[model samples]
Target: MEHPAALAGPPIGWRDLDRVLVVRPDNLGDVLMAGPALRALRHAAPGARLDLLAAPAGAAAALLLPEIDAVLTCSVSWQEAGSRDVPVAADLDLVDRIGHGGYQAVVILTSFSQSPWPAGYLCRLAGVPVRVGMSKEFGGAGLTHWVPSPPDELHQVDRSLHLLERVAVPPFGGRLHARVPPGAVRAARVLLGDRGPYALILPGASCPARRYPAGRFARVAGRLASSGLRVVVAGTAKEAPVVAEAAGDVPGAVILAGELDVPALAATVAGARVVVCNNSGGAHLAAALGTPVVVLFAGTEQVGQYLPRFVPASVLTVPTGCAPCRQFTCPYALECLDLPPERVAAEAVRLAARGPVRTSAWSSVREPG
Candidate 1:
């Protein structure tokens, strides 16, 4: 389904784009990294309705971006290949819904390893007049603008802007963005009432390969808490056991796992003295909130590519032969995240001095239910 521009003259793109749909069917961290590109789209099409197509978890996180007016969620089967839950009909319904959205352009941003043609094809099927995507392969007829993907080592934040540049959407800014809702800031204050000099320990990661042992996290938290710094261990509710293993027996350790939503989490990160986390979304979120971090850099990906930037960072990772494997699980017994708790604690303490002190922000607030 080639657009009229292909048949008439030069290929279609940003020239007359309105009601644009940005598709990034990935995790929260990926969506957060794409913030700069989203802002560019908002700037280019000021009055246009900018909708984000994200995975369910990504959809929730995407709401934090002020540039995005709305989020449409999809847990497509291909995202979790061989899953019996998502039927073919579900994908068809997504096409139907998007077709009725009246979008003039669809920009498909993908990771270096991911193929953008499938997403471009769906947008084509939806009759979006202009389909823009990034890939190394020839885009065939599915995409009107097949922008070549940048180097694998290019940061996800930069990669998004590179794709948009092909469509005349210039770079807006080079900063990770997330608006901390006032209500969520209040919630953070209530949850962490009167706690002074707290360090946030995020004990969970998107995959086991990236997760440092819960017991190791506990040791770090215990060391920090014992030093009169309140330790706040956070994760999803499903990470309660991991959170407990990290927070239990640590005096004055606050367990906010399952308590903070995206906004609340942003506030909590903003209010913390320092954040110790894996190479995960929490690391990005903390960076967006202007907090220093001590990252347990699992070697599944490049250190410079994903490690949070624009903030002071202390990364702890062991050199491994199988680095950049990009595997969900480490075959080498997770050697990359094998840093000692003492080292992690020391880094956290060092960063805490440089990180912000938000005791004044905790002065007054209602409790979170």
Candidate 2:
């Protein structure tokens, strides 16, 4: 493995790298959206060992990505909202680990709402020679390759691809990718107890601001059941209560919250006729599995940016005058929740009837909004 110092140019290319550490310390949805960029890095440097430094929420998704050779977990204070202060010991430990990993380059991935300067500084502290990130902050001092942030209207996946371009890694498939092992699929099938087609409803989000109302989800589940589709409510253990509320006495509805892991959840989404979820990780996982999705998006302003574009999805939002507030708590009103259950159920039913969407004509299959 040639060291960065051994390379002649100030900015080294993929040929000069033997191993790269890609840092995406955020939630599951964020990591899933980085799939295309990860693939691009792998495609460009096929022999280079690609590793991921992910947050706990995103660790499982990182492990599931075939392109990643290793996964490291790091819960940063800036990435998670309202968390404890930065753990100085943990931060130093991470820096020490990266310094010892013999990495040639460290690529820090961040969302439009986040600044990558902090992660880049950490890499620099670890003595990583080639530090790269997308940033407009910190005067771009720490980054060897500071890619300017793209337009806000760009989708999260597209933004990641743009960032990877700083290292000359082009977009690979321009799509989301995930892996659900056959064993996980079998386990999920057993949990379902029946082979009949079912509609998956993810009724929880990482933040309350992004979640649809529980009652509305229940009504939608009932409507789907009434239409002869089995409803399956799935979420994490922490979200079990919300999932149970959403599954509310809907005939033929099964509540599997807290029972499935990420891979199993992916398998469940892949097996479903369609997925109805909040603007959360479930929607991204469904998109990766090629399942049609109906998203009850509570944040209208950033819909074009966060929502997955590579899948057939119907995004339902009220389009409030002050939409895209990007606030955890709505000040005036929760206008986005006004998306009627009837409308959402109609969209889900329509997509279910169409079954899984396999073609790349995503625009033709999905609604413009």
Q: How accurate is candidate 1 locally (lDDT)?
A: 0.82
C-alpha RMSD of each candidate structure in angstroms? 3.8, 6.0
> Would you estimate the TM-scores of all the predictions?
0.92, 0.91
TM-score of 2: 0.91
Alpha carbon lDDT of each predicted model: 0.82, 0.81
Q: How would you encode candidate 1's per-residue C-alpha lDDT over 172-236 as one tens digit per residue?
A: 77788787777888788788886467889998888889999999999999889877688999999
Clashing pairs for model 2 are: 301-324
- The sequence of per-residue lDDT tens digits that candidate 2 reaches over residues 132-213 is 7876454345677777777778888888888777556778767887877767766877888654678899998877888898
Instruction: Say which candidate scores most in lDDT.
Output: 1
Best by TM-score: 1
- Candidate 1 steric clashes: 0
